[model samples]
Target: MHDLIEALLLGIIEGITEFLPISSTGHLLIAERWLGHRSDLFNIAIQAGAILAVVLIYRERLWQLAMAFLRPGHAAAMADARVYGQPPREYAYRLAAAFGVTAVLGVLVKKLGFELPTEVAPIAWALLAGAVWMVLAEQLAARRAAVLGERAAITWTVAILVGVAQVVAGVFPGTSRSAATIFVALLAGTTSRAAATEFAFLVGIPTMFAAAAYELVDVVGSGEAAHEDWSALGVAFVASAITAFAAVKWLLRYIQTHRFTVFAVYRAVLGLALLALVPAAD
Candidate 1:
């Protein structure tokens, strides 16, 4: 009963911030530190709840890909499809391309990062960096009015940029997944609303699934009470899913009219507070 309650609390926080310009991982990191929950596995697995939200919301688009993929030549044709006439193959190709780069770089980082056990990844820097990027995003949006268009507006460079940013974001929390990737989209000249939100959803499918899997495996490997805690994890996942569903709906509409300035302010304040609260042990 107690663990169930604790998991729900964490899940609420995760679902709300997962897709927002705010960093879900950052909030989760803080929540775990302060909330007295010692289970990294639970934290990680609940992210799947949020991932499911995106997968379902984009089910139609994803379904299109599923059908196209079972057939051959889908990937090649997608790469050459028109902007206005983009089909599932296009989305699949872009995801594949982005994932390819992300996989190569992410693997190297993980391999090298594991070797350096004493290092901290500067998560605070990630948040502060996000603040700067958000501010710049406002300027970019003002300068351009790029729309989502009939199809995804991602080019090869834009896809690469988003993927690379995710790698950096993977380096630290508080650096929001959406914030970093959106900035790249903005720089690649995507309009604010279109670039910030949808592409965030786009790349998130794989990232969150991978994270959820990693956590689950760890929990099982640790011989923790993960099986016993399935009930608790379920509660947490449902709570997070409900919260995320609402947050995503609200955010898509919010970004349509509002600016990223509000989130930037929040990130700035949160960044400074973390820096002040937890100085080095030295």
Candidate 2:
């Protein structure tokens, strides 16, 4: 019962933080300090749940993109192409580019045996740095929006940089992947907040699912799956999916009228508090 409760709490945390410009991994790491450490497979399983929520939310958009290939001359497809300054197929190509970069770099990093640091101090520092980066990046993006009047086009440069940002976020536990990719898109001249957010989320869907699959394979190969609590994991997976659906829905609506500075402020406060508390715990 206790384990189930902890799983539920962790799932909620993962779901709420996953889509926001707040680091989900950071929150999970902090929660583990009290809830007891979880297995890598468990973490990956909950993350897959969050990814599933995004997949469900974007089903309509995904369906349109898929249909664009089947019916290239369709009126709706052409209209979407004009709005995005590219055909749906081209947009998908860009997404593929971003994913390709991440896949190659991520594999290389894994081959190099680089692992995420589990220490609180490094995570705290990363959180603080990411807050500062968000402020500066948003200001730059806002200025570009003012001049360009917002753009939905995803440039090749933006695609590549967003890919690199994903790797950076992976290397730094406290740097949110969505935050990194969205801001990188904005800074690379994709001025529309909605566009940048959509691209980031779309790119994340595949990246995260692939990552979860890789981790699951690793855990299974290492025989760690035998020790996992399947019932608790199931509860956590369901909880994560439901909560993530709500969280991402709210975020999509919220960004239409608000900037992400509020999240940066929250990160700054939490990061500072964690840093201060770390010394006492030591």
Candidate 3:
């Protein structure tokens, strides 16, 4: 009973934070520390369900993608970002590029296992850096109302630039991939609403799916998370999906009137609190 209840609470937490620009990874670490539960692959695997929430929420667009890229008659430049005046798909191409860049860079970094220790300090640095960037992001959001008109199209230049930003995001688990990419979008003249919401879903689609895929591979190869635990996985996933959907809706509404600085500040404070509280072994 305790295990199941703990699973539900953590699932809800993951669902809430996963979509937010604040770091879910950081929150998970904090949860482990505070909950006093032995963390395991079960908690990590629950993210697959959170990922599914995004995919299913945007099922309409994903279906459109199936038609756009898979079918020959679909000439919707909407997917191209360069010519399509419509949102998402135009934005999606940009996201794909960004995800691709991050994937390549992340893979290389994982392979090299660079001399720089994978310490918790980087997470602290990311939280602090993201907070500082949020101040700039607010200014960009205010300016974007007038700016996107002259720069309507999402050009390859912006794609590459956003991609580079994603690479920076990948290096630091607490940086929040959605926050990084959306900041790029907002700075590049996409409206705050469009950039914040679309970038959240668009970049998140591939990013989350890829992460799920990799974890699946790891689980398969090492039996880290068993196929036999599918039932438990399902429970966590459904809870996560419900929570994620609610969180995404709330976040979209919040971004309309609120600047991101509050969340950023929260991340920094939380990061510091964790550093002070958690033992050095962590």
Measured by lDDT, the strongest candidate is 2
Candidate closest to the true structure, highest TM-score: 2
Local accuracy by lDDT, each model: 0.71, 0.91, 0.67
Q: What is the C-alpha RMSD of each candidate to the true structure, in Å?
A: 4.3, 1.5, 3.8
Return the candidate ranking by TM-score, descending. 2, 1, 3
**Over the stretch 167-269, how does candidate 3's per-residue lDDT look in tens digits?**
6666667787768777776676656455445654666667666766775677567876554455555566678888988888788788767777788879879
Where does model 2 exceed 4 Å of error?
71-83
**Tens digit of per-residue lDDT, candidate 2, span 178-200:** 99999999999899899999999
Task: Work out how many backbone clashes candidate 1 has.
Answer: 0
Q: Write the per-residue lDDT of candidate 1 for residues 1-282, one digit (tens) a residue.
A: 777778789889988998888888778767766566546666665787888877877776666566677854654465533322445566567767776677777878877854311112355566777888889776765666644332236667777878888877777767787888877776675554554467657777886677567667767788885445777778888888888888888887887777789988888888877777665511
Q: Each prediction's TM-score against the native? A: 0.83, 0.96, 0.81
Q: What's model 3's lDDT at 16?
A: 90
Instruction: Provide the lDDT at 179 for model 3.
Output: 80
